[model samples]
Target chain A: MMVAEAQINNNTINLLEGWEEGLDKAPEWVQSFRKKAADDVMKTGLPTPAWEDWKYTNLRNLESVTLCEASSLHVVPNISSPFIDLKPIIVQLFNGSFVGEMPDLPDGLMIAPINEVWTNDWFKGFVSSLSIDTPMEALNSAFLNDGIVIKVSENTKIAEPLLLLSTYENSKDMLSVMPRIVIILENNAELNIVEHQSGIGSYVCNQATSINLGEKSKLGHYILQDNDRTQGYLFNTTKLNCYDDAVYDGFSLNHGAKLSRHEIFADLLGERIECIINGAYNLISTQHHDTTIKTGHFSPNSISKQIYKGVINHEASAVFQGRICVHNDAQGTDGHQLNRTLLLSEKAEFNAKPELKIYADDVKCSHGVTSGDLNDEELFYLRSRGIPEIEAKQILTKAFVAEVIEGIKDSVVRDIFLSISIEEGTK
Target chain B: MRAQLGRKKESNYKMIKIKDLHASIDGKEVLKGLSLEIPKGEVHAIMGPNGSGKSTLSYVLSGKEGYEITSGSISFDGHDVTNMMPEERAALGMFLAFQYPVEIPGVTTINFLRTAINSLRKARGEEEMDAISFLKLQKARTAELGVTMDMLKRGLNVGFSGGEKKRNEVLQLVMLEPRFAVLDETDSGLDIDALKVVSKGINSLRSAERSFLVITHYQRLLDYIKPDVVHVLADGVIQKTGGAELALELEKHGYAEFEKNQSNGAVA
Candidate 1:
């Protein structure tokens, strides 16, 4: 395995100099957080195949490309909503920097760019609360280019979902961006958040979302990342902390980008918490997508479900690794995972690894995986009924991934995802 | 005279005429020197024991994969159709009800039927069925086939009972309304009631303008279908051609005598 310590160290040192120059914009502690996080990342470096978790995904290509840091100068690219009829509440970000215009938000909702509200006591306390760090989480905090914070007050149920769109406009250079997000829902509050990424040029989008759900609160987090550039890179890390009787639903669809990975972690800290994490990847030629999910059941009587479906097209590859860990005292835990892959061509490949580490005796956990190309009998059955081969392929492929798409609770968002993914498959 | 002319209208040349079809799967020959013809207004039943190549003959005509016809000619409605795709043959009004209807997960039965009918309509240069008309058409046929409304919303034949699967196939037969239909072992795993329902569905489509080729191992389905002509197939060729009485005779006596005769003929 090639070491990326030197490659990452150079970028971290350069970013530190930039952070010191803008010390007033950020507080003293934010600067220290950046420096300390950078040092931690420099020590650990990028993950290689030697690590069991990163076995199938290679980071050699990512480490070799020394992309430039994001500049403050922002230019909004012309991006229309893919869902024409759905005028969702939109929060736009350019190159990891917020485009701070005002939109009318409902009561009990507060959304502001983290940099603009860094001095608030809640922001400072929430930012400095966590101490333990993983390599990717440290890397995100070290070179944090921009961030957002959304706090929903207690007993509020928002009607419309908030869409946070981070677009990397026509890049003059190969840029690298790290966007951080923190969402906190108070007791009995409910909120749905959708994170979207779109761009036209070569760049690396590395971001982390940390969510905290108070007692009886509900949260749904969705990530839709589409980058068609062959050399682009996108990696997202989403972590959720759930309290008693809270519900958390996280879903992601990695439909574009030459290389992309979404790592999701959920911690069920209180009883009766239920979380469902489902995802799908529609990959094309020479593209690689990896989805890694882990859920820890720390309290008794919690439920966790993970389901993923991927279609690997010609010369494309995908990987799914899911693990459920039940602690010793976490009895009555139920965890189920199902991973399915459809190889669209002879050259496409899909690999799945599902694991369960349970130290409790009264837990129920199971995992299963299936992967293959379209069934010949099914195709012939359709063709024998008068459907042309082209249309037959489209129908069968769409049907193959429909089970996962139907997992999304919202009908409008479901329709948009369905159309985009089917369009991508047909092409 | 009017009824006769009505039958003659669709039988421009013939409903189906297959000559000397020699087919194989995976280098193993299944059909050798098989020939048959069906007129527009007749129902033909081909009965044979196991491995007698009855299903292979149906598959070759329907253009299924893995059944390669080395030397043959298949004519459908006067047009040579040996090289056509499955969809093309279907567009020409050829339908095959599979012995094992494929269980396609996530495809609703109603959606599948609509797509199939529209594609065929498009091929025939006819206007596609609108949603309202399609719903009416579907509800009427599904009600007759004893298919519940809930089954239409579920995946096509997935997790269905064997009787439900056969009913679904018959429902497709009712919806497609092809010029010629091939029912391959439609009564294989059916009970008496299911068989009656399926046979009723098939009987409803009987007309002077349509023909059927019922392939079965036993004479039970032939009893319900009442074919106009019956052929005893053994070793890939028709050993005997007779009226519907041939089915009763075969039901009384097993296929052991026919196998001996075919082997003796080959030896001679």
Candidate 2:
């Protein structure tokens, strides 16, 4: 195999300047962690297309774009309430920094800046135990300045969902904002959280979210990224760890960002755990989005599922990479994955790769992938019913992605995702 | 021998007329210069064996693509619609009850009906119906058809049985209230009960200004939906025409005679 030595190029180094100021006031361990991440970045550059996993994406695109660090000036936009009827605890983040007054959270729940919890033993241990897998994640850890930490005490079932609304705006030449979030739910706890990212100006939002679910806990996680398509890039990574009898349900809707990649890694470390990762993307106008997920079943009687669907229009492209690994001890594991995409134009493209590594003989695993245009029979049926050609196409396209959104277990959240998908798919 | 009829003077009563309509699919001719005419306020039934181009005729009438007209014209309500789209034909008060209703997995049946109704209204320059009004109308039309309100909430014909699909089509027919309709084997998979419900829906819409072309393979449906005329289609052309008795005769004797005559290139 021809090996291309991964080295940080000068252009990438130029983007990493002015990082010391952000880390000067951080705790000693945090500073060392950032320094080690920066050293790794200098030794091994950002991922190039030469890597097998990133063969379809090229980091060189970020080199030409002048992405300076986000300014200290806090320019908060007039944001609107979420389009859901259920009253949620709203937390707004401007340019990756937590802004606005903190709401009165319910008892047994805490939401604070990440730095505020840095001194706590559990939070410190969690931060120190993170092992960087990709160069992009290393870049995030190296320059991370602002983020929030959410924790739910044991046996606490929060009635309202927590909405993390992050908005970004670049006043100067393209800006880069790296935000990290950590969520911990103790035993027998349940909580629902949604993160929405939207902004106007050109910027790169490189963010990461790590979730730890204790035994008998349930967490419903949702990410809706509807950033400006022409002026932004998003790289979001989610790392999840589930203990015995823990359930991690996650869904993502991506219709924004000129280019984006949402990668997820879930570790079912204890028995009887359930992990569901589902998402839908509607892209148009030369936009690109990638969804990569890896689930490791280390314990028996665990279940994992991944369902992703996309609609690619006008020269837009998308990628879906799903990898499921069942260890020898993970007997009685049930894993299923499916990916489907609709290419609306001749120039639209979709690439799917499904990898399954099974070492357990008693496990049940299945994966499927399909990519095509709309069905002619279905289209003709709608048109014959007096629906115009254009409207018929839109209806069918929305229905195509709506099938995936239906996998969302929550009805209110499903409707919110459906409305956003309908609005975006029509475009 | 062609069943010839006397030509009538052009009047205000709109009719569907096909003149030497020839259509082909994939370079093979399926409708070979077929011609038929149905005046207003009449129900005509066409019976044929398999591969006799009955379905092709229905598709051609609704302006489905991939079927080259080759050399012919189709006109409805004094308007030339040979080159029009399926939706255009629908806007002109034309409807087709498909033999097999398509299953749209995520679009609910009620939403589909509302969209169709609103689109037709827009095309006709009329006011669109709101949700409440549309629901009231739908409830009224579907009340006696044995279609429960729960079916409307489900996806369009997604997991419906054969009878349910046919009932849904009849429901659409009643809701749309088109001036011209072509029922393409609507009785193919339905049982006796569904046939009556469908027939009732069709009979309710019969008026002096509306016409229908019912395409069927069996005579069972004709017992419920009485037709004014019956035509025998064979080898892509109409071979014979008679009164309602013709459907009974075809059912009793089978399509053997028609098939024999079709091979001989005979028209009666």
Candidate 3:
């Protein structure tokens, strides 16, 4: 391990040496977090196949490439298909650094840089209470320059969603972007958020998002990552802390990037709390996508349901690993998880591992996963009806993905997601 | 005899002709040079016992995969349809209702029907149907078929009872208004009430321009729809063809004699 770290450090010394100049401008707390995170990252290093959680995704290529701190480029921002019609407070992060334009946010909503929050005593204390065990989270905290910090006021309802857009524009340089976002919804407050991360060229985007929900609060969160064909690595971890009677609905659609990993952890702390995680990913060519979600039921009468659907075409690959941990004290817990995959081509691959760790025997918990191709009888029936083979396949694929997309309550976002999925599926 | 000959001439104007069809699956022959013609403006029932290639004929005519047509020719409305794809056959106004309708988990029946209708219309060089007109037409057809609007809104055949799936297939036939339909054991799992409803829907779609090839193992469905001709499929061949009484006769006599004749032919 020591020799490996030494080799990695020697190979990536040029990538790690440039941050000293930027440290002078960062806040004191940001500098301290970065130092600790850099040290932890050096000790832990990039994950290997030996790690159980990352066994399917190989990060050896990521270690070989020397990463450079991404800077603000002069490229114009392109808004192709806006998923929703809400007038969101847009906070744009271009290549890991904040682009200095902040939209007029609603009253009681705080949209500021992460470093700015580190300076504030209240938010600093709030973040200190949350767990940050993963090395990626530590790295994000350490290198965090300008990421969005959303603070919703107590009992306030936000009419529009908050849009956090992370774009990668500079491909001429090998870039590493570590973006951090923290959203805190107060008691009885209602909010909707859309996080969009996309890049044009080969880049490494490591993002960490933490969401905290107060008592009786309702939140709808959407994550859309559609990047270019260039080799890209994305590490996203979303943590949700729910209090009593709070309801959280999260939908994630990952359609791009060469290799992507999404980790979500939901801690149901309060009684009567309900959380729904719905996701869909479509992979083609040689792309690889992996999603790992864990929901911990700490309090009694908490319910969480997860459904993840994926379609892998050509030689692409996908992985879905979901775990539901119900504590002994958490009685009357009703948790169900289902992962279904449609392999469009024989060469494509899908792997699903659903685990249920229940300490309470009284709880109702179940999980099922199925991987298969389109049904021959169904295809024949459609063909017999005079529908062409391609059209039949398109219809079947659309139907397979519709259930997950329809889980999104927002019509505009659902429509956009469905249209994009259909367009990409046919292509 | 002269009236029968004239009726045959008129049937030739609009009918599907299957000439000495031979189809196999995984090298096991199912349809062994079986041949039959279903004339327009009439309903024909093909009743057979288990392992009698009743479903094979339906699949082969629909151009389903895995069923290799070793030697056969199928013509629909004067066009050679042996090599046509499923959608092409559907665009030609041909429909097949499977005994076990597939469960499309996420797609709503309404959306699927609209897409199928529009696809067929587009293939025929016709403009797309607007949502309002499509819904209006669907409402009338579904109401006649006794299908609730909620059924149409749900995922196609997902969580639907057996009878509901059969009725939904009939609803599609009514909506698409196909010129020819092959209903393969549509009444297999349906009870008497559902059978009557489904049969009524099929009966309403009957016309001089449309034809039906109803495939079933029981004679009960024939009692409801009444076929112009009844054929017995035995050992991958049509062993006998007669009027509606033949169904009642086969139902009472069973297919033992036909099976014996098939084995004798094999031995010869």
Candidate 4:
């Protein structure tokens, strides 16, 4: 008992108190990875406000919740998706474990559990190559129990999007879940994926996804985190690698969760590649959100663009930290980033740190950050047209986020996002 | 040539009455002790130089913020709207055609018009216009206003040319069918062809129940939509009132004569 108390004191906050025993059931390779991750986490613990990247987000709510590992969840909970009407193939991941049978697939497409694919050479190589940049990522790696792996063969084009719907619900003991997603597209392949995450109770969900796009490949990745607004805490890490002539267009919509931190790291590995990342979030009450991005331009003639817009109301606060690094060999690289937020209440706050580290002289890179209340001119214009004041504000707020949603290339996906954004942003 | 053939004479019923209108912006008085009246069925023009409070009067009448009425009252169609909100004033049939129409991105012009029309209808306890009926009315109004349907597809006044913006305002005036409209420098940026199209659209809305206050620096617009009375506004007050010929006279002599007379009268 004395040693346990001393260990807790040394680790600051030990989330592995009740969740460490079940991790032994994972495979040998994952067991080793988990061993190393556990050691690293014991040394570092979770992110705190002292960390520069987490300055504005405090984990006070997470420390009080007693989290335990979820048992083998075989019973499929009846669940519906936000895009259920679109009829896409829905793959469910309950309590960080992929459940249910694999849906029908077209030619050259593969989907399997990570436990089944851990022996594959490419899967081993990919898992070993992951860099743990933060304690949350280490926690995800440490407790890596069950996940999914999706691969697209060369020259394959998917007709319909695949929805990876992850749901976590615990009414009893608060659960901590870790889910990993690995996606790889061969040369000249194309795919669209919509990742939706949600939960019910005060659970801690830490998820990581690794994506690799081969030469001339195209991917449209959309993510929506609509967890329980008053309870859940989510930490997401997305690492992307792009080859020559590949395009990775990604957008995230965050309007849920009591606290969320979404970190993205994109590595431009090959020439003439294009990476576009855009996001829009609406936070109300005491909700807090953070988006931290790091894009490395390593090749010549690559382009990267990031645009984020959010509306913060009530006592909610949001943080945006975006950094673009252009290496010496990355000549002719074009990078742009912009973050604009609208504050609906005087107590609402937005903190932004936009940085550009360029060693290439010929690169064209710029960033901008703006935050303010709704434009009085815009509000007055709408009211002058006989719309009531409250309705006028709603219209302007909806319009503020319309640009990000409408920029989506796929019409169906665009419509879904547009409806959600309009609904949440106006409210 | 002034088009006086369709001009309506002033009636006994006053549609709008501005009494001793002393207003200010940013604590600096702009319209001091100014008074004007426009009876039903008649169109009145208020011509003034830059900073003569013509725009202030229009904004104040339309209930825009930042303009405080020090001590005056504005009544439109028998409703005292001094403390009313902008939308409330709009519901009372008061409209101001801005000199610079604001650009609202992401909202299509057609959507804006529909919302405005439906809001007005709802405010008056009428059922909102159905979509099909709105489209039909929009088709007729666009045709009458000489505005292309393509312009309505884009964001409201976003990327629109100066002429297109003025025409859109005129299109809105026709759509809303307000009882009182203030054309604030509606002809400032319009070229010859657009000026004629916008004036023709405004002329089509002229009725015995409607009134207008045309505020302009030049008399070019009065040539197309003839006003029954033209008032010379200088130094925050109306100095003279005359027939349609007054506009042509101001156009020829300019506000220089009015400024000189006002300064001379101030010295006395």
User: Number of clashing pairs, model 2?
Assistant: 2
Candidate 2 docking: what grade?
A: medium
Candidate 2 lDDT over B140-184, as tens digits, reads 999978788889988899899999999999999999999999999
> Candidate 2: misplaced stretches above 4 Å?
A1-4, A421-427, B1-14, B261-268
Per candidate, the number of residue pairs that clash is 0, 2, 8, 0
Q: Pick the candidate with the highest TM-score.
A: 2
Q: Write the per-residue lDDT of candidate 4 for residues A173-277, one digit (tens) a residue.
A: 777778899899999999999887778887878888889999999999988777777788888899899999999989888886888999999999999999999
User: Against the correct fold, how does model 4 do in TM-score?
Assistant: 0.95
Residue range with the least summed lDDT across 10 consecutive positions in model 2 chain B: B1-10
Candidate 3, A53: how far from true, in Å?
1.9
lDDT of 3 at A89: 69
Which residue pairs collide, candidate 3? Answer: A33-A142, A34-A142, A383-B86, A385-B90, A386-B87, A386-B90, A387-B87, A388-B87
Choose the strongest candidate by lDDT.
Answer: 2
lDDT per residue for candidate 3 within B132-211, as digits (tens), equals: 99989999999888899899999889899999999999999999999899999999899999999999999887777788
i-RMS values of the candidates, in order? 0.5, 0.6, 1.6, 0.8
Cα-based TM-score, every candidate? 0.91, 0.96, 0.91, 0.95
Query: Candidate 2 lDDT, tens digit per residue, A112-138?
Result: 988787878888899789768876677
Docking class of 1: high
The lDDT-based order of candidates, best leading, equals 2, 4, 1, 3
User: Could you give the DockQ of candidate 3?
Assistant: 0.63
